[model samples]
Every structure is written in C-alpha cells, then in structure tokens.
Target chain A: MRGTPRLVAALCTVVVALLLQVTVFPHLAWNGVVPDLVLLAVVGAALVTDARFATLLGFGAGLLLDVAPPADHAAGRWALALLVVGYVVGRVAHDHQPGGQRPSYPVMLAAGAAGAFVGTSLFALSGLVLRDPAVGVGELLEVVLAAVAYDVLAAVVVVPATVWLFTREPGPRPAQVTPRLPRRTPV
Target chain B: MSLDTRPPRQRPVRQVSTPRERLEASGMPSRSLLVALVLACVALMVVDLSGGKDSPIAPVRRVVGEVIGPAQAAVSEVMGPIVGLPGALRTNDALRDDLAVAKDRNADLEAELERAGYNDNRYDEFAGMCQMIGDLGYAVSPAHVIGYGSAQSFSDTVTIDAGSDAGLRPDMTVLNNDGLVGRVLAVTSETATVLLIIDPASTVGGRVGDNMENGMVDGQGGFEADRPLELRLLDNTVVPQKGQAVVTWGSEGGAPYVSGVPIGEVSKTFEELRLGTFRAVLEPYVDFTSLGLVGVVVPAGDDQRVIAADCVPGGTR
Candidate 1:
C-alpha cells in the first residue's frame, strides 16, 4: 500500500479502535482498567507504516482521545504518550526488518507491551508534574501494570489484523503469474 | 478488467522500491516531524493547564464531543444488550432475591401508609415537612450513560446522552436512583462529560447522619468494586460509627451539589494519632462500575416549585 490508501486505512483503523476503547471496552473492563485499544492500534500502524507517518497518526489519535467526552485530564497528555509510542515502535520495527516484512507474533506482542508501557508512563509522569490530583505512586504502578498486560493481551489479535489490513495488496491478481524478465546480455 | 490488471503492474513497482527509497520519497525528515509534533503536544498541555475551565481547548473538546459523542451513543445503544447479557445472567438469581425482599418492604410501607391515613393532603404536608427539614428542591433531567473515559487515565468520568440542549451545564449535580454519581464538567449540544465522585480529584462537602456533622468527602482514586471514599470531618472530636449515612451539604446555590442528596454510608473509621484528625471510610451507594440512567439536577424554577408543592399522592386531577 502506497500513499493515500495507506493513510486512509490507518485513519480508519485508529478511529474504530478509539470507538471500541471508549464505548465497548468499558463494559468489559478487568479490574477497572480497559485495554488501551487506541494505543495498540498505533503500535499496529507503527509496525506497518514509516515512523513519520505513524507518528502523525499517533498524534491525531491521541488528540482525539484527549478531547473526547468523558476525558477530564489536560489535553495533549495522550498525544505526547502515543507520539513516543508510535516513534519508538516504528523505529524499532523498521530497524528489526528494514525489508518491510511483518514482524513475528512475539515481536508484535513485545511492541504492544513496550508501547503501552511508554504511553502509560509518559501520561502518568506528566500527570504527576501537572499536579493532577488523580496520579499517585501507588495508582501509577497499578495503571502501568494493568495497561501493559491488557495491551499485550489485545495485541494478539489487533496487531496482526492491522498489519494484514495495511500490507495486503489492494486488488486481487492471478496467484502464480510471473512476468518474464528479458535475458541480460554481457556488454 | 483494467482495474484488476493495474494492481499486478503496481505490485512489482512497489516491491522494487526499497523502504529506504520510500522514506526518502515521502520528503519530510522523520526525526524533525516527531520533534515538531512532540513540541506541539507539550504546548497544548501547557495551554490547557494554564487556562483552566475556560481554556481555549474547550472548543476542541466540544468539537470532539459533537463528532464522537453520537457515534459512542449509537454503539452503546446497539451493543448494550449484548454486552449486558452475561452480567444479567449472573445476577439473575440475586435480582430475584432482591425482588422478593422489595415486595415485602413494599407491603410493609403500604400498610404503614394506610395506618397513617395517607391522602393527597398528607402527601403535600410531607413535602412541606421535607422542605422545612432543608430539602433543596431541584428538578432533574434524565440521561443515559453512553460512554466512559479511557481506562488508562486515572480520572473517572462518563459521557451521558444529555447535554446543554437538555439544560445541562458545567457543575450541575448528577445522581442515579441509588445516590450521588458525579457532577457535570463539560457539556456539548448532545452530550455532557461527568467527573465521577470516585475520582481522586473530587471533593464533596458532606453531612453525616443524625447530628449532621460536617465533613469533606474525598475520592480514593481507582474505583474498584469495593473501594471506599475518605471522609474528614471538620471537628475531630466527634467519632462516627459504622453504617452512619452521609449526604451532601450542598453548595451556596447548589451549582455543583445540592443538599439532601444521599452520598454513602460510613463503612469504617480511623483516627490519625499524630495529626489528631478523624477520618472515616464510606462505601458510596452509587456503583461506579455499572452506571446507566442518571438524573442531572436542574435548579427548579418558581413555577416548578409551586407544582412540586401541589404534587398529589399518585396523579394530579
């Protein structure tokens, strides 16, 4: 997937993930923490797209999360958190396989856990700096642990599906057709 | 046929171009872009923090609410029954037992009412008595919980289907059937964000049972099913026992909270010896986990108050 189509697909994936994050997942919360589906979606995009594009996607997604109704915290906390997640994930994945191949399952899972940890920690630290009444040492530890565990659990499904969506060829083609190459003559 | 053939030709072209070439082709430097975005995020946070409630970020939040709020409400409506099925099944037996207990209580209440010679006049007298006993009467607009805040954030908040169009504004008290839920923090045309009472940042002035001792109720951060609120009374000498009810002391005009709204009950008490302070833990009557329909208390107008005074036993003739 080249430029415009890939961007559109990434946008759609993030929006859907955000919808699930705010609406459906709250009902299925485990121990008062819902899986960070939007963060996982950013990780998925990072795995499939370049660092620059993934970072942009993460910024947009995080801004939406920040401003979305029911969000009471200062704006841009999630934006910063996810921006780092996208950049780090994209860079690591790119370096791991410069050929643009899909990462292995374990790699994807690790990226998800790492992304969750980075995002949650950044958000929590910023909250502490801002003197946000919600963040304390104990709460921070609990949130970080729960967020990483949930993101990793969700990554098993969300990451692979997102990668396939982004990397899959746009149109169907003949399975076994190979174009003949002109014979190279010594000059 | 032409569209089908295009993908095959494009595939080889894409395969031939390496990731490095593609990155260079995209033009902008990746590291700089990241830096710029990070700076932008930091600026937004700074602005939001400095500006407080009337922040420039309000418009952005309102736009997001208008755009995403409807979608969330739609998804919630469509998915609510399906998602609730398992919990409903698990609680079915418990619900039946509750129904039996409620029926018995209803009969006893009805008999008591009969013995007291219940009538429309008596009902009006009771309402007058309640007002005399310091009931801050406020009309309520009902709404449904459409969405919740991202669980990653430490603050507890929920989006309700009602908003400014429904006469909801910031700081309005919100409550459910059980007890006080929270207060409105922001409102759009069709939705409002409520900061739940259980959020650590939340502090509600409360009155304790019988003597109506004054205290400040503080939220204890995360809303685990069994977590309790911390209440610090102004006077440290008075010790509250377990099961003493708590109610809001109400603001001056009840902008954020109204008087006579039940908050919770004391579950335990603790005294800090060194600080010489008294504190109690309260289990809130409102279940933070499973909020559904709730009412946003709108200060009643004079006409509404008159109507309230004229309220009959069942229906007005």
Candidate 2:
C-alpha cells in the first residue's frame, strides 16, 4: 500500500538504467556485457512485495528497458515476460517459505539471475524469430548468459540494499494486540 | 500465543495470494499474463508474420512506444557528451583532411564558375523544383530540434523548439539532416511534437527518386529489433529495389515538405509479396539515434485539403 509511488519511481529508474546499460555501457563494457540495474530492481521489489506489485514493477521496468539500443521492438513481450517472472518469484517465495523469514540471499540471487537470464534470452529469441530468422539460438543464449551473470553480480549489493530499505520495519508493529480493548483513549 | 495480549487474525485473510490463485483470481487465461503474452506474441508474430501489413496493433504499439521513447532519448542525450568525444576527435582529423581537399575543390569550382556555367550554385534538376516552390508562394520557416527520443524511444521524430508562436502547425512536415522525419502532430505554445516517419503510427506519401515510382512509407519503427526506424513501400506496381532513393512528393506546392529531399534508401525489398501490392523498406536518410539539426516546414494554406486528398481514389499526386 505504501509502495506505489516508490515502485513507480523505481520502475522509471530501472528503465533508465537498463537503457544506459545497453547504449552507453558498451563504451565501458567488460566482456561485452553491461550490468542490468532493472534486474536488481525487479528482484529487489519482488523480494519484499506481493505478486501484484511485483508484476507491476516488472512490467514498468521491462517496457522501459526495451527502448534501449533503439532497435528492440517487442516492448509488450518484455513487459509480459518480466511480469511473469517477478510474479512467480513472489508467489513461490510466499507459498514455500514460512512467515517473517526472508528468503536466503543466495536463493534470491539465483532467482534474480535466472529470471534475468530467461527474460533477456526470451527477448533475443523473440528478436531472432520475429525480426530476423537468420539469428541462431546458440549465439543469443550466450549473450543472455553473459547479461544474466553480469547483472546478478552487479545487482548483488544494490538489490539487497533496496529490499532492506523498503522492506524494513522501523517502529514497533502497529500494536496489533492489547490485553483488553480500551473503552477509549483520552484526548 | 500471549494469553493477556494477542492480536486476533484479521480473518486469516491470505496475506499474499499464491501465484496460481492470483492468476485464477485475475482471470488467468484471457486477461492473465499467459494470454496477454500470447496476444503480444501473436501480434508480434502477425506483424512479422504478415511483414507489417494488416496488423491492427500498430496504434497500440505507438502508444507504448511513446512511453518508452522519452526514456530512451534521455539516456542517449546523457551519453552524448562522453560518447561524442571520440567521434569528434576522429571527425577533427577527417575534417582537416577534407578542408585541404575542399580548398582545392573550391578553387577549381571558382575557376569553373568563371569559365563555364555555375549560375546560382543549385543542382540543375533541383533548380526546377526550387523555382516551383517559390512560384507556389510558400512561406518557409525552418525549425531546429530541441529534444529527441531518449531511452524511451529511438523513433525518428523529434520535438522542435518552435510552435504555433513560431508559426508551426499540426501536420506540417519536419526535416533536417535527412529528407522527412515526420509531420507535426501536436503543437503547443513554444514547442511542437513531430511524429517521425519511424513511428509505428506514421504514414507518409513518398516516391522513388530514380524511376518516380510512388508509394506510401508506413512506419516500421517498433516493428523489428536492431532496425530502430524503418518504412514500408506500398503500391505493388512501383518497381524499385534495395538502393532506390525515397523522397516526399512535395505535392501541396512544396509547402509542407519540398520535393526531392532524401527520405531514405530502400534496403529490404519485399519482392515475393502482394495484397494491394508493392514491397519496399526505407532506410532512413537520417540516423535518428544520432541527430543534431532539423527543420520544420511551415504549413501552407488550407492544409486539411492535403489530408483529404490523401484519401482520394488514385492516392497522392
């Protein structure tokens, strides 16, 4: 409930970051891949939120990211796929894990990495199939792997810090219980 | 369980719904991701599958594109300073060489101008068209690009710093660095939004330079990957191939957009297709991902007549 605007802002940041990752980072590329800020943000959002919010976050991030390189055209596909991934991560974590315990850092990392890998791969695959039938699956897969690994490593810290910031509970819980219901509190 | 103080469960309301439950609750198949994705996939498939003709999602794509386009443009703008340095340095060396060569060429041209015919320094073929434009009584007000598609889009259109105050109007042609970028779609007080030819929703009347073959250059802006902006040629009867030039017809007496300006060269030719007929791809003359200067053509009188004429049976003039 409190995260809508923040989530929107994060989505905008992720989109801008991803666009930078594709266009400018090449000038600063390490091994032909750029760090994916969108992945970190998506994973971070999903780690502490429900599926609906996570989906919304992923959609915003994906649509923004697709604008990078000025070439990728399937904007909706990225939005839909990332939404699926984030929603799944949120749903699976909530269903399997016990309450109040955060998923292990490595598990979250792996999940984030895997989702980015799949999402990026699906994009390349879509590009190859829909745009040019000349691209082979293997070449695209390599790029996907590189992008995923780079994003996971770079996002390791950012993701956790953001999740910690947003998910942290700062005050005493909203006093969920009392010995007896007070008739009324004095003004 | 604290005996004295315990919060009652708020109806044990499932705090976070399961993925499957969420999907079901959200109308899984049709409205859920699977269907939405399927529809997207189908749409993309249909566009590529049909080669960008007859797909109805083009307008929807343009809307989505406008959202992403601004961000894309912004990132590119921020990256400009750093990325441009190397290119600028290289250009410096190249320009120095070109300067020496240009000096000799200029000297030769001056001598040639005195000895032979150099008249007004305009190309012969274009001379007629230029004169034609003047004869039409058009008031040409050039504009420059103040903004572009950032990380949000790599679309070819741009925002000119001019607007109605600058005498710019809706549907006026915009150009610079290339032939046709797009027509002015929205105008404000001091600025106007020009829908570039690369926008998925953009459709412009264009012709081939060599053979005078005419067709419509429909936007393939968001159609494919790696091809940021593209245009299609219709009118199956017009024959041209990968190297033929594209330009606007300059019909409205050369008011909106003048004749013979370079739009793009045809890259991919759809030779094996038909349905109302031709096949052509416009490789935009302007590199939209990188643009610095542009011009907006001042609108002529009764501009809506052109829009009306665009729908006539025989197509544009």
Candidate 3:
C-alpha cells in the first residue's frame, strides 16, 4: 500500500477504466447496450482492497464518469453512487469472508454484481427523479444487462491480477468501519 | 519477521470514522446511510414535483462537474479520429439499415426542397428578400455560431460572429432557417451571445394566430437538464393541444421579437391541481442543438423607434 509503484498502478487502472467508460464503452453498444467498466473497477477494487482504498477509487472513477459524454445528470450522482457501491461492497465482502484474505473470483463477482446494481440504479434514478427526464423501462434494463456482463468479465480476469498486485506487497490495513466525508468524491 | 512487526504510521489518518460522522462531516446529511438515501430521494422528488424550475443547486453541482469536464472534453477530442472505427466494424445488416434510413431521409428532404421551389429562387431569394425586407425599413445582419456557450448551463446558447461592428444590439432577436433562435444576451464588437429560448430563464410572450389567449412560453427543462421545453397557457380559459403550430405573435405586438416567429409547437400539456392551469410545453421550430446560419434583427425604423418614445419628434425620417 505504501509503494509508489503500486499506488501509480492503481491510479492508472482507475483512469484507464474511467477513460473506457466515457470514450470507448458507450460507443461499443450491442443492440443499444454498453458496459459499465468504471462500476466494475470500483467493485473490483473493493473486492481486493479495504473500504478506504475502494472509496478513494470510486471517487475518481465517478468524477471521470461524470465528465464523459452522455453525461446528462446531476454531477455528484455518479460519484455518490460509486462511493456507496464501493463501501457497501467492501463491508459486505469483509463480513462474508471473515478472514479477509485476498479476494477470490466468487467474492469479486459478488462485489461486481452489487456495485453494478447500486451504481446503475442510483444513476438512472437521479436522472428520472431530479432531472425529470422521462426514461422507459427498456433503457434501464439495457444498462443493467451491460453492467452485469461487464462485471462478470472484469471479475474473471482483473480480480486475479489485483490479488497478485496486493499480495505482492501488502493489502490495505483494514476496513475503516466508519465512513469518511471524503475530501474528494470517490469514483 | 512477524506479520505484526510493523507499527502504524501517523495512526492511519482516521479514514472512515463512522458512517454517521462521515455523512455529517460532509455537511450534507448526518444520519444512517438508509436515512441519507431516503432524504436524497425525497429531495429529488420535491425538485421534480416543483415542475422543473431552475434552482440554485446547479452551481453547486457544476462546481463538482467543472473539475472533470475539461478532462473528459480532452479525451473526447483525442478520440475524435478513433470514432469511425467502431461504426466501420458493424455488420453488413446494420450497414444496410443505416443506408436505407439515410436514403429515406434524403428523399424526404429532396421532396421538401422541390416543393418549396428553392430551384426557382435559389440565386435571387436572399438578395431579393434582403431588398424587399430592407425597403420595409428593417436592418438585417447575418451571423454564424462559432461554438457552444457555457457548458455548465443546460440552456442552448451560441456565440455569433457578428457584433456591434454590424450594428448588433442587445435584445436583438436572432432567427435561423427554421424560426426564432434566441435574443442577444451579451455583445462585443466581434461577438454577441444569444440565450436560446429553450433555457428556463428565458420567457417569451407567445400567442397562436387569433387565439386571443396569448400565453407565456417559459423554458420547460431546468438548468442542468436537456429536455423538450413546455409552453403553458397563462390564460386558463383556453387549453392548447399537441401539434398546434405555436408562433410568435408579431402580427399583434410591435415588439422586436416579431409576432409571427415560429416557436415550437405544443409538445406536452397537462393540468395539475397544484398549478391549476393547463400547462403545455412547446417544441421550438429551430433545433437549437444544430443551429448554423442565422439572421440578426438590427435596430430598424418604427420597431427601434417605438421603444424609446412614441412621440417620434420629427415624424417619419
């Protein structure tokens, strides 16, 4: 956690995932479906790292996602969604795992599912409620499918690499138990 | 070495104090996460039910947004060349569908142009219209939008190339191929900013031909959102329906906006007990998103003269 190289890698990972979310992911729609790579990464981070680390990553990812094209909602919506997703995932994962060693594929996948649900639901609801933009059920379902698919795939490959990365040095200390006001919004 | 050998550095920064404290310290909500979620939801509902008025919360959101917008714009710019790659990778079937749609749209446009008799007046129309309109004592100046207005504001605004050098003035109405675009908001020698009527802050007097109940057209969507605007009937006696050609009543008013400028038609109308009026939203004639060549109405005779004084000291110039 203290190593500069690892910190940079995590930062780069978050950026790359967010870049994909904004630039490439939305464009890669199949029958009007696109992946939520940022959400996947947040869940992926929570699965391996502690709540503190996950929350930070979420803030960054959320910020990037907010700025992207098709960004048609309240600003903090994505950040808030990602932060909540990461925290909830990290806490629940810790609870289920108990020992809290490196995360396994199942744990990462579970975290991914939960994160996607929370992220997409909050994002859509913000648009529907706060903005009063009329959206249909079909569009929401499409986002859900995309998020789930992206999460499943990301968890398959990224979790192992993250586990190795964390195990290489040392993992985050432990879940912070209490949430922080967070200087920056977590991606 | 024991796994517990290392001592803590600076006591871990007290990262996550407690969920409640975290929520409270943020100055947003100090409660259980569930409570916070409920509060946010309730706030959202209140904002939504308030009938989509522009609120002060946008600047707060924009502050958060401004931090990341530039980076996203940069990435979008960088990815410009990479855009067409994915489209090219589409299957033949999808390509055929796209081709068919394009062809259909092309045919429809061609027919419309033919019907409008653009071929007959292609060369003479602008010059002739310019002369005809100028003889009527209206100074016409041309303008083009160079770029978008402020990104933080959801209202559609554009910066035009013509300004005071062309004798442009504030409140000068702007029009495009379709209809009224907006009125000039700010101006300089080289450029002038026009606030599109689609913005929530913009209010224009609208009355369809002889409807007698010339209602007020207010921007439907709030500041941070992009949605079709609404035109509510200020006078409750008349209810407006969809597809009604809503035009500016320049025929009646000597106002600079002109009476007959085509605003959007009635897109939505509803009666709510709270508002107690038939509120209808109009879809503007000019598609603000893709506006290009536009006309600026500079100060012209009676139109310009009436504003200062109806006296007309020396009579007709």
Model-by-model DockQ, in order: 0.34, 0.10, 0.06
TM-score of every model versus the real structure: 0.50, 0.39, 0.38
CAPRI category for model 2 = incorrect
Write model 2 residue lDDT over B237-271, tens digit each, in one string: 66677788887777575545566667888877666
lDDT to native, each model:
0.82, 0.62, 0.65
lDDT for A90 in candidate 1 is 80
List candidate 2 segments past 4 Å from native: A1-10, A16-19, A22-24, A67-69, A98-104, A128-133, A168-187, B1-34, B37-41, B44-317
- For model 1, residues B159-197, the per-residue Cα lDDT tens digits are 999988877899999886577899999999999999998
- Mind giving the per-residue lDDT tens digits that candidate 2 earns over A1-187? 2445555556555755565566566656667777766766777767666656666677766655543444335445566566676676667656666352466788768777877776677667667766644667787777788888787886677667656655666556786665886689788
lDDT of 2 at B210: 85
Clash number for model 3? 21
lDDT tens per residue, model 1, A1-187 = 7678887898899889988898888777888888889898899888877777778888999998998788988999999998888888887777766756778888888888898899988889989888865657897888789878887899899988888888876767769968899899889
Candidate 3 residue lDDT tens string, B116-194: 7654543333443344334334445667788786767766678999888777778877776467777898889999998
* Candidate closer to the true structure by TM-score (higher is better), 2 or 3: 2
Q: Of the candidates shown, which would achieve the greatest lDDT relative to the real structure?
A: 1
Sort every candidate by lDDT, greatest first. 1, 3, 2
Better of 1 and 2 by TM-score: 1
Show the lowest summed lDDT stretch of 10 residues, model 1 chain A: A92-101
